[model samples]
Target: MSYSVHVLHNGYSYLKDGVMRANCTCTLIKGPNLVIVDTMTAWDKDVLLEGLAKENTSCADVKYAVGTHGHSDHLGNLNLFTAATHIVGYSVSYKDEFFIHPFETGEPYKIDDSLQVIPTPGHTTEDVSVVVKTAHQGTVVVAGDLFEREEDISDPSLWRYIAGSENPDKQQKYRNEVILLADHIVPGHGPMFKVTEDMKDVARRDQLTQK
Candidate 1:
């Protein structure tokens, strides 16, 4: 089955008082399974519920709730998705029941033929990114903090200085990999952006070799 990716909410991030005040981008994928990626902050719960209602989906219908990382901004509203199989970073759970998955070792969790969750890390070392293949969008990568925004593709410093990635080198490497694999990307704290050859070139950490 083919899937459709929807940007339920585009998040924002800004630096203030040596702190990053941020909200994570929340996405929805509908196909074989109803998936919600990054629930956003708790304060935005009502807004998230409303967004789901508008799509004719309820929290109860969601089969999977994926938090790109353990950050509060990303998983704050997870309590709303109790029935969903929860994927928070490298851990998977449902209520008190837990299931093991080797995300840390690069094993991707497949939700369906059209959707999969791949380990991305870098932001906090256990981060994940959702990849959706749709008829219209081709392939869309729901990249969490691995990319702060579209500008991060062109300016490395924009993300390096603000995202505080735990492993800058790995983040950069995977960011390049995602850019190469995706037709579009939904970044952590910004609007979606189209992938282009120029963007791929800019994202690559090593320019000596060509792909």
Candidate 2:
């Protein structure tokens, strides 16, 4: 399967749907710098490089390669961009032998002045989502494993894996943020969708009902 590169509203180019069920990487290009959101498997590294090179983006130009969490699939093949800076959440360091090298660092991506970290840790202790107001995308959430369009965020079954496992408190926090700040939901898996203004009220009502 051939992957198609699409430019997102945030002035980033993303790869969607090649193989392995749309595990994608989104790139933010500005001047000579690129910020790669996620890296796929080791086998797909060359393909990712080729695709980025075609768009005039490269690991050499990468300012940061962000792994949403410490999952092997998310950060394992990060060797492709040895030149790029690797960043992840504080909690990710707990994953055993997961750190191939000391190159990977940890930091939180700030949202607003008031809303800095959208700590959605149930997916993993390190699982955190980012909320940023982009010029074209308005308010959007790059919600790695925290939220997925493939399943309803409100689904109780979603809690089976993470509930009482680690940082279970974040499950409700994740749901609450989706209803408030998200104009668009950009998943690390599956398609991206906009949460309509009308839906905001419904989402809020859903939150209240769930409570």
Q: Which candidate is the best by TM-score?
A: 1
For candidate 2, write residues 156-201 as lDDT tens digits.
4434342222544555556566657876766655466677766577
Model 1, global lDDT:
0.89
**Candidate 1 per-residue lDDT over residues 1-211, each given as its tens digit:** 6788889999999889988789988999888898999999989989899899888999999999999998899988999987899999999998999899999789999887788999998888899999999999989999999999998776778678877888888887788889989999999999888999887776564633434
- C-alpha RMSD by candidate, in order: 1.9, 8.2
- The C-alpha TM-scores of every prediction are 0.94, 0.65
Name the lDDT value of residue 207 in candidate 1: 38
Cα deviation at 137, candidate 2, in Å, is: 1.5
lDDT of 2: 0.52
What is the overall TM-score of model 1 with all chains considered together? 0.94
- Give me the displacement of residue 187 in model 1, in angstroms: 0.5
Clashing pairs in 1: none
Model 2 segments more than 4 A misplaced:
1-33, 91-118, 154-169, 206-211
User: Which TM-score value belongs to model 2?
Assistant: 0.65
